[model samples]
Target: MPVHDPYAWALDFEALGLVPAVGIAYSLALRRYPAERWRIACFAAGLALILAAFVTPLHTLSMHFLLSAHLLQNVVLAEWAPALCVLGLPPALAAAACRRSVVGTLTHPLVALPLWLGTYFAWHVPAAYDAALRHPTSLIHVEHGCYFVAGFLFWWPALQNAPHRLSGGTRALYLFAAFVLAAPLGLLLALIPRAVYDFYVHAPHRIWGLSPLADQQIGGAAMALEQASVLFAASTYFFLRFLGGDERAEAYRSLQRSS
Candidate 1:
C-alpha cells in the first residue's frame, strides 16, 4: 500500500551524531601522537562510509524495509570500514593495541578465525537475523556491533604484530582458507531457489521491480563479490611477499623499522 521514495536521501537523525563523536574520539585518543596525514585520511574515509550507510536513506531502507540494504551496511561495517580504521592506526599504536594480553590471547589466527566464522554464520541464520530485525532497536545495533568486532578480529591477526607470528607462506595460506571457507554461505544464499530469510518479504516498495527474494539474492551476490575482491587483493599481497624470500622480506622489514 505504501511506496518508498527511491530518492529519499535523509533520515535517522541520530546517525549523524556519530561522525563528530568518532572524530572527537580519534582526535583525543591520538592527540599526543602525531599521526601521518594518509593514516588520518584513511580513518576519515572509513568514518564517512559508515555515516553514509547508517545516516542516509540506506539506514531507513535497511532497518525498516530491505535486507539487501542491510547486507550492504553489514559489508561496510564488518569489512571495509573496520579494515581501513585498523590500517589507519599508526604502527606503534597498532603494535601496542595488539600486544594487550587479551588481544594477544584472542587474535591468534586459530582463535580469531574460528570466532569470526562462528559469529558471522550464526548471525545469518534466519531465526537469528529475523529476531534482530524484530526485536527492540538495540538488538539491531548489537548485531551490527558483533559483525564489526568479528571482522576486526579476523583481519587483525594478519596485518598486525601478533603473539604467534605467521610466516609469509602461512599467512597466504591462512588468508586463502579464511576467504574460501567464509564464502559458501553467501554463494548458497545468492543461488538458492527460494528466499532464505522471510524478514524482508514485506519490504515496502520494490526497487526497479525487484522482488524481496531477488533483493536478498542480490545482497548475497554483493557480499560474495565484495569479500572476494578484498580477499583476492590481500591474498596477492601476502603471496607475493611469500615469494619475495628472506632478503626482500628483511628489506621491507627494515623499511617498516625506519618508518
Candidate 2:
C-alpha cells in the first residue's frame, strides 16, 4: 500500500532548496575570504541527497511498512543529512557570518545548545511524529532544518570550523559529554515495546508487511547507529590530537634535558 501522497512528495523539493540557498548565501556573503570549496560541495550534496530520498519513490516505498525501510529514512534524516551539512562548513565563511550581531548571538553555544536539545526532543515527541506523517512536506522542512542546525552546532567545536574556535581539550570534552547525554535517549526509544507514533500504528502502509512496533524499533536503532558514528569519529580525532600534543611535550622535555 502507498504510505504517502505523490503530490506531497513532489512539493517536498522546497526543503532541499533551503540547503543550497543557505550555503550559496553564505558563500556569496563571504566570497572575499579564502573559502573551502569541498566543504560547500559536501553541504550542497547532502541536501541534494536528502531531497532525492524524499521526493523520489524511495520515501513512499520505505514508508510502505518495513522496519528496514523505516530505518533507512531515519538514517537519512538524523545521520547522513547532518553529517554532510557539517562537512561543508568552511572556517572562513563561518567566521565572516559570525560577525553579524544577531547571528553571533544566536550561534552562541548557550543558545545553540538548548536549541539543539529542543529540536531533538520536539521531533521525537509522539504528537510531532504523527503530525509529520500527516503533513509530510511541511514537517520535512522543519525536520531537515533542525537536523542541519543541530549538526552545524555539534561540529562547531571539533571542526573549529565556526566563528568560535574551542581548544582541542574543550572539543574533546564536548564530544564526550554529548555521547553520554544522548545514550539514555537512544536506549529509551529502543526499549519501547510498541509503536509510539500513532501514524505508523494506524496507517495502512507496510514494507514487506512488518509490524508497526518493529518499525519503531528500527527507528530507535537508526538513532543509536548515528550516535555511534558521531562519537567514534569525534573521539578518534580528539585522541590523535591528544597523542600528538603528548609527543611534542615529550620532545621538548628531551631537548631541555640535553641542553
Candidate 3:
C-alpha cells in the first residue's frame, strides 16, 4: 500500500510561467504609464497569489485529492486574482482597453454578468468537471483559462476607472445582482445530499478521512462564504461612495443658496 501525500508540492510550469511573464509585462507598462505605488502592489500581490495557487501543495491536492481544495483554487483564480489584477491596471492602459469596441461590449455589465454566470455553472456541471479532471493537461487548462477570462470581464466594469465605468450606484447594484445570481450554485453544491463530482468521489486516496459528500459540502460552503464576503464588501464600498457623492452635491447646493 502506498502512503498518501497531500502536502506534496505540485508545480504547473505553464501556470508558474505566468508570474514572470505578467510581471515583466506589467513592469514594461509601468515604465510607459507610471502607475501609482498601490497599483503596482496590487498587481504584484495578484501574481503572487496565482503563483501560490499553482506552486503550493494546493495544486497537488486540488488535482488529485480534494474537491474542497479544487473549489478553493477556483475561487482564487476566478475572483481574488482577477479582481486584484484588474485593479492594478494603469488608468491609461485600462481606459485604452475599455475604449476598444470588443472589450467595451463584452465587459458591459449586462453581457459580463451572464457570461461569467454561464461559465461558472457550465464548468461545474458534473460531467464537464470530471472530464477536466480526467484530462488535466488539456481540458483542465481550458477550464481554468475560461474561469480567469470570464472573471476578468466580470470585474472590469465595476473596478476599472475607464470612460465607460459604471457609476457607483449602478456598480453597487450590479454587484448585488452578481451576489444574488452567483449564490445558487454554491448553495446547491453545499446543500445537495450527494457528491456531484465523481472525480473527487473516486479519487485514489481521500485526505483527512473526509467523505466525498462532506468534501463537496465544504467546497460549496467555502465558495458561498467567499463570494458573499468579497462581493458584499465591494458592494458596500460602492454604495457608500454613492451616498457620499449625493451628500457632496447637496452640500454644494446649500453653499450656492447661502452665497
Candidate 4:
C-alpha cells in the first residue's frame, strides 16, 4: 500500500513528550540515590518502546489504518512500559511512594484488578472507541492516560519490585486472574464473525489489503498472545518461588549478601 501521508512522516515529537519528562525525573532520581546504570537504562528503554509504539509511523498506521497496530500499541503503553519503568525505580523510592495512605487502598488487588480490567473493557466499547477516534484531541488523551495509569496500578501490586510486597501465592493468583479476565475479550475479538468496531471497518488505509474483519481478528490474536506470554511467565515465576519454599528466600538472602 502507498504511504498515506509522506509529509506527516517526520518525527512525531508531540506524541513523544513523555520521554523527556521521564528522562528529567530519571536524572533527578539518579542524583538523589546511587546511579545504578541498569535501572536508568531500563527506564530509558521503556520510554524508547513507548516512543516506537506511539511516535513512530506505528502511531500513524494504528490511528489511521490497522487494528493490529493499535492493539500492539496498547500492550506497549499499558503493559510493558509501566512494568519496565517500575523495575527501573530505586527500591527505596518505590517503598517511599508505597507508604502513602492512598497507596494502600489503591494497591489492593481487589481495587486494582477491577480498575485495570474495567478500563480495558470500557475503552473497547463501540461508542467509547468511536468517540476517542472522533475526538482525538481530548477524549483520546483520557483513554490513553487512564490505560497507562491503570496499567501501572495493575502491575504495582504484583511486581517483584513493588514496594509493598505480596506473598508469592498472592502474586501468582493475581497473574492468573488477569489471564482469566482477558481471555474472553480476546476470544470474542478473534472469533467474532464480523468486525466488532465500525471504526476499523471503515478505516481508509489498510495495509496488505486485509479486510477489516480479518484485521480485527489479527489484533485479537495479538492481544491474546501478548497477554499469555507475559502472564504465563509471571505466574510461573511466582509459582516456582512459592514451591521453592525456603530455598527461594535463602537465594534472595545470598543475593543481598553478594550485593
Candidate 5:
C-alpha cells in the first residue's frame, strides 16, 4: 500500500532550492545598486517574505487546497513584492540600469509594456497554472519573474524612480487607469461559473475543506483586494501631496491679502 501525505510532499526540493537562490540574487543586485541602505533592507525583507511564502511548509499545505492560501500567494506577488521594490528606488539606480545597451532596449516603453501584459496573462492560463503545480521549480521561476517585471512597469510612473518620470498629475492618471483596467481582469476570474484550472478543481482539499469553486472565488477576491490596497495607498499619497500644494498656495494668497 502506498501512502499519500500532503504535508510531507509539500516540502519538496524545488520549493526549498529555488526561493533561496532567487532571494540571494535579488539581494546581490541591491548591493550592486546605489539605493539607500534602508530601502535595500526593506527590499530584502519584502523579498524574504515573498520567498518564504514559497519555501515554507505553509505554502505546501496551502497548495493542497485552501483559498486563503492561494490568496496569500497572490497578495505576496502583486502587492507585497511591488510595494517593497518601489520603495527601493530613487531614479538614479533605475536610470543607470536603463542606460545599459540591453536594458535600454528592453526598458523601452513598447518592449516593457507588452512583456508585462503577456507575462501576466500567460501564467494565469490553465496550462501554465497546472504546469506550475506539477513542477514547483518552474512555478517559482515563472511566478517570480512575472512579479518582478510587472512590478517594475507598475511602479515606473508613480515612483518617479525610472529613467523617465511622469508629471505628478499624469502619474495619478496612470495609476487610476491601471486600476480601472485591472479591475475587469480580476472580475473576469471571479465571475467564471466553471472551474478554470483542472488541477485546482481535482486536487485534494484542505484548510476548512473549501470546495474548488470557493477557492477560485477567494483567489479572484484576493487579486481584487490586492489591487485595491495598492491603488488606495498610492492614490492617498498623491492626494496628500496635492492637498499640501493647495494649502501652501492658499497661505501665500493670505499673506498677499494682508500685505
Candidate 6:
C-alpha cells in the first residue's frame, strides 16, 4: 500500500490521547500502592497492546484495508488488553475501585456477560457495522469505546477478588458460558457465503488480494480462535482451582476424622 497523505497506512491519533491519560492514573496509583513487578509488567503490556491496535498503521488498515485487520483490532480492545489491564491492578486498588455498589453490580457476571455479548453482537450487525465504518471519525470511536468498557466489565468477575468475587467453580462456568455464547457469531461470519458488511465489499483496493468473502472468513476464524484460546485458558485455570480446593477440603476432613 502506498503511503498517501490520508490512507489506510496513516497513523490514527483518535485513541492516542488515552495513553497519556491512563499512564498518569497508573503512575499516581503506583505512588500510593506499590504494585509487584509482574503487575507492573502486565499493565505496561496492556498499554503497549493498546498502542499497537490504535496508534499504529494497524488501526488505519482496520479502518480501510481488511476485515481481518479490523477483527484483530476488536479482539485486542475487547479481550486481550482488558484482561491484562485487570490482572495488573494492585489488590488494594482493585478492592477500593470495585467497592462501589454500582461497580459491583455492573461487574457481576450475570450483568456483565449479557452486556458484553449484546454489545458484541449488536455492533456486528451489518447495518451497525456499515454505519460505523461510514462515519469512521465519530461512530467508530463510539463503537470501540463500548467494546473497551464492556471488555473490562466482562473480565472483572473472573479476574478481580474484590467487592464481589465468583467462586472458582462459578468463574470457570462463567467463562465457559461466555465462550459458548459468543462463539457462534464468529462461526456465522465465517460460514456465511456472502460478505456481511457492505463497506468492506466496496473497499477501494484489496490489499492482500483476498476476496471480500475470504477476508470475512479469515476475520471470523481469527475471532473464533482468539476467543477459544483466551477464554478456554482462563476457564481451565479456574476449573483446576476448583478441583484443588475440593481435594484440599477432602484431605482436611480425612485428617479431622483420623484425629
Residue-level lDDT of model 6, residues 101-212, one tens digit each, is 8988898889999999999999999999999988977999899989888998999889887877578899999999999999999989999999979998988877768999
After superposition, the stretches of candidate 5 with alpha carbons farther than 4 Å from their true spots are 1-34, 89-91, 101-114, 246-259
Please give, for residues 182-209, the per-residue lDDT of candidate 2 as tens digits.
6656667778887787777776755554
The lDDT per prediction is 0.78, 0.65, 0.89, 0.79, 0.64, 0.86
Q: What is candidate 2's CA lDDT for residue 168?
A: 57
For each candidate in turn, the TM-score is 0.87, 0.77, 0.93, 0.89, 0.75, 0.91
- Model 4: residues >4 Å from true position, as ranges? 1-3, 6-11, 160-163, 246-248, 251-259
Off by over 4 Å in 2: 1-11, 16-30, 61-75, 246-259
Better candidate number, 2 or 4, judged by lDDT? 4
* RMSD value for candidate 5: 5.5
Report the C-alpha lDDT of model 1 over 139-245, residue by residue, as the tens digit: 87788878878887777777765456677777778778888988987788899888766678755556667787788798899889877888777887888887878
Candidate achieving the largest lDDT: 3
1-259, model 4: which lDDT tens digit per residue? 3457612442555556767887888788777765477877887887787778766777777777887777888878888988877667777777777788787678778998899899999998878987887775688778877888888888888863445577787889899999889777777889999897878887766678799999889989889988998987888798888887855787799999999
True-structure RMSD, every candidate:
3.0, 4.9, 3.2, 3.3, 5.5, 3.7
Which residue pairs in candidate 1 have backbone atoms (N, alpha carbon, C) closer than 3 angstroms, thus clashing?
A: none
The better-scoring model by lDDT among 1 and 2 is 1
Off by over 4 Å in 1: 1-4, 162-165, 246-259
Query: How many Å off is the CA of 246 in candidate 1?
Result: 7.1
How much does candidate 2 score in TM-score? Answer: 0.77
Pairs that clash in candidate 6: none
Please report, as a residue range, the 10-residue window in candidate 4 with the lowest summed lDDT. Answer: 1-10
lDDT of 4 at 29: 71
Ranking by TM-score: 3, 6, 4, 1, 2, 5
Worst 10 residues of 2 by lDDT: 2-11
Query: In candidate 5, what residue range of length 10 has the lowest lDDT sum?
Result: 1-10
Clash total of candidate 5? 0
